[model samples]
Target: MTHLSGGPALPQERRLVTAVPGPKSLELLARKNAAVAAGVGVTLPVFVTRAGGGVLEDVDGNSLIDFGSGIAVASVGNSAEAVVRRATEQLEAFTHTCFMVTPYEGYVEVAERLAELTPGDHPKKSALFNSGAEAVENAVKIARAHTRRTAVVVFDHGYHGRTNLTMALTAKNMPYKQGFGPFAPEVYRVPLAYPFRWKGDAQACAAEAAEAAIDQITKQIGAENVAAVIIEPIAGEGGFIEPAKGFLPRIAEFAKANGIVFVADEIQTGFCRTGQWFACEDEGIVPDLITTAKGIAGGLPLAAVTGRAEIMDAAHSGGLGGTYGGNPVACAAALGSIETMKELDLPARARRIEEIMKPRLAALMDKYDVIGEVRGRGAMIAVELVASGTRDGAKEPDAATAAAVAKACHAAGLVVLTCGTYGNVLRFLPPLVIGEDLLNEGLDIIESAFAGR
Candidate 1:
């Protein structure tokens, strides 16, 4: 393998032989559409045949630089050497026994690693699950069990998951919660510190908003009835919104004083996606419970809840676990992914991605009156679009502009994804191992698309 200054060298620059959903991808898509559920959203039409580091090759002989990283699941890069090797070796030995039933070294090893790597020097424990939503639901269960409280508080624009309880925790309605609710009860929503739109000093605004939210919660539901306050250090699906500098620390203090559990849902922001092992560390706030998924196990479905020992122990003997939770194969992948992350210093690489993206996005904001804001931490970044010239004039995002730019990027051989409540934000979650040349090429496509060139 070729080596670059920090990591492996990129194979080559992007090349497109046909339309994005070229003949091969279109043919496979037609077959997939016939059998797969329509509700499953497909971001780009291109079908990947091979991928490594930062590039995805389609069956139609097109190479596209991946900026989405399979929705932040490939932080170590697609087909990471360590992950592939470990997974293959584990496949040769064993696949599944269900950690709860049979127990295994891999499962225990991963749990121990999590406890060590997660924030806080206190005694911590971890439990593995199948997805971010499961970890979130379990976190609530543990919090409630420990505090003997009923209500759980979540913030606006915070995305927990799609499960019933998490659905209630989530803020966006359409697609996620739209015809699917009769959502679980005992969940409440509060306003978050969105600095871009709010007026005042960033830190003061965050502290005041958090204090007001706590006051509202106490006045309305009473802290005695509350179980936990869940938040994303940097809101992921919620347009990559980063809480103001002092926001997380203030919230952590409020939770501590009120005897409420603080849950950090790091599903998208974890595993070095945000230039740190955990985004909460940026503010030096140690959450009582932290939910993780996305990049934990390379591309495997493994989620975890790591937190204080007392709280986690509150659950009954059989209260936490699942049939496929902590599958051995997935555990192996997680081990490899974590090892690769440390050995290669992916967090520093993530900072490099931020360094590269910030200026390009800033240029876009300067050139396009339609671009409203560019925000995020490290490689987990997003650009929000608004109709030209409007402060309070219909703050609704421009979905059409987002869709047009995404389509143009695809046509020009770049893979991108759109997010946000109004679908007006373009999020970039490129693998930390991405090559500089390929990343710049993808950014160029974004610029060209915005310029309507």
Candidate 2:
């Protein structure tokens, strides 16, 4: 197994030479507080100097286990050789030509690969962008132009992006939407078939949620006015909630019947993160449009909107693009990332991650009442926390316990992240290149945190 990640071969072990945030990190933290905006948040205060494989080496000389993978962007490891090599070559050749003015072969090549890799065998087309929000916004634009409709439908417990329209589509309020109202109009919200929180079994939940969504569109929004129905195959930022079995297919059928575009927001679940090239492939969903980012270009800022050729080409000439859309360097990184995923069989790697992680998380649930559920597919896994000591443990979300456990893990040199509408989920997104030994060590830190709690 080619386990040697980019930088100096970091030994697969945890080493804390100083306190979690030692003198150097503390100094930088002070500087960050003075210069950085207050709205920006930092999960762990430590300053990272280098990261690869399963470890992040901080400026303080602490080798912390990376469980978040920079929010699932570093699936091939932080500095995979191919990504670094291609990006370096591209950088040396030319950093930017502003593809709008003078296009390059790299950008076209990346889009071609996306056309081939994204779900569906139908004739497809792609347009690249700078972020997931950009891709989603463009997808909405294309759908509206094609259908000549104004209304767009999204689901509860689904997060699209942080931009104006995406924030309107997002369900959560406190952080993402609190004081940012007066959002874009013509966006409608519906129910998702969230299995853990739904009223019945998986099949029943799927059936009921589909009916509820259809009913809402028929009455509240009016199906004729709708342009698209967008959803995450495995909803990220809404606690990694995977819809109940059969839910997506039913929704897709509804959209097809109504002439509404079906969009899969695969920002966090794409690029082999969910044991498949795209999460929509699991249920054979062929969306009219798909938004991708985060893991698409290693760690570079790149995203794309790929879909059926007819739908994607509906927008008129010069209708969609940005100043930095499909920048040459980011395109190079994306091509390298795709090559690495194929050569290394990262889809199988993600499945192996699930095999190792799900069992441990399930065991944790078995022992702790605070853990209400262990859910998600492949590497995109999460544990929902609920208040303990009650007969029905899943009744109340336990944000306090989740916070404490995250703090404990940070103190012990394990980088972990938390998410969910209620702030009660601990998400694990280890890099696909992470070694089993280092993965176990990070889990050990989590186990110790829970035991102490």
Candidate 3:
């Protein structure tokens, strides 16, 4: 086994050559414009040549620090040796056999690992998919089949996926759902406990919000008609907002009492992103179903829905699978990724990242008038930008300011990503393997950007 410590050395510091989207990357962008769909949002025009640990080398020959992690997909770091070797070896043997038809050992092994790693000591079962959206959609399907209900409840600022069903489940409406819906029905939205915005005690706010949601469901759709209450423990794209302290526990209690399946969407927060195996583990609340993707296979397209055995068994044998659901190569990559996560103690690494980031971010909050909030769990952190001193800091998000800051950071040879309904929050998902000095350097650049602004 290739140890995580044995990977190629990361660059000591960021270095930029040509402008961010240099000549070669500009040429590629031109080609991409002609060949690819315009709906895709490209943050930086620079094209990647290679990536390892926490740095990305562009085709332009610039070595840039990666704070985006391909939107939290590279938690195990880009091109991890174990993942690469396992994927290559699996590729040499066989690529696909359609696990539902001709099963493979890798597929079964991945499922077994998920069942063990996911939060809960109870009997568990898992099914694989190709993306987070598929995992979430299947969780709903299983919940509905088990509960015999039609309504699914998701919280405000929650992000599930882009599928029709998930679009309805998603909270934001503009980019994800604009012109794309006519969405699937039976989805309900409830308020989430965002302490930074809410005007009450944390526990009280959670209890009130959850009780209100439960009442609304019972009044409007009836609890008997609600199949599941799906949520992201720490909201990801909807501003990386961590739920209020008692919020998750309150929601779990509601789900337990109401017989509604609780689904924890850990796609962006899982695989040790939040210093825990799963974010829900922090509250010690075990959901009936869990959806995961992103870092699961260390950049390969693999997603999973793990849950109690009875709920998973509710779906008929042939009713729950895809042709490429558990592709052999992806499964091999997942096995390697899981092994890497355990052997390297990535969860401990995530805590180290938190230790490094928290104080710096808190300092930014104190210095920058535009920084309304600095929040996250572990490495899945974000800073929400709001215009200074408007309506008790409830000012609308300033996308222009955010764009400028992001561009400035990129010019300084650091890659950062901006996300939020209003495009005003900058999220950081640096690879857990990033060296402390490099991580501090990236944070320093961000501080400089805020200072200059």
Give TM-scores for every candidate, taking all chains together and pairing residue i with residue i.
Answer: 0.96, 0.98, 0.97
> Which residue pairs show backbone clashes in model 1?
none
Clashing pairs in 3: none
lDDT for model 3 comes to 0.88
Q: Can you rank all candidates by lDDT, best first? A: 2, 3, 1
Q: In model 2, state the lDDT of residue 322.
A: 92
The candidate 2 region of ten consecutive residues with least summed lDDT is: 1-10
Candidate 1 on 373-434: residue-level lDDT in tens? 88998999899888877623555578899899999998898888988877889999988888
Look at candidate 2 and tell me the lDDT of residue 16: 95
Q: Which is the leading candidate under lDDT?
A: 2
Off by over 4 Å in 3: 1-12, 199-203, 391-393
Residue range 1-453, candidate 3, lDDT tens digits:
121433555564678888887899999999999999999968898899888777889999988998998989888888888898999999999888899888989988998999899999999999999999999999999999999988999988999999999999998888899999799998998888876667665557776777777778779888888999999999999889887787799888878898999999999999999999899999998989999999999899999999999999999879999999989999999998898899889999999999999899998888777888888878888888888774255566788888989999998889999888678989999987777878998999998898877
Among the numbered candidates, top TM-score falls to 2
Sort the predicted structures by TM-score, highest score first: 2, 3, 1
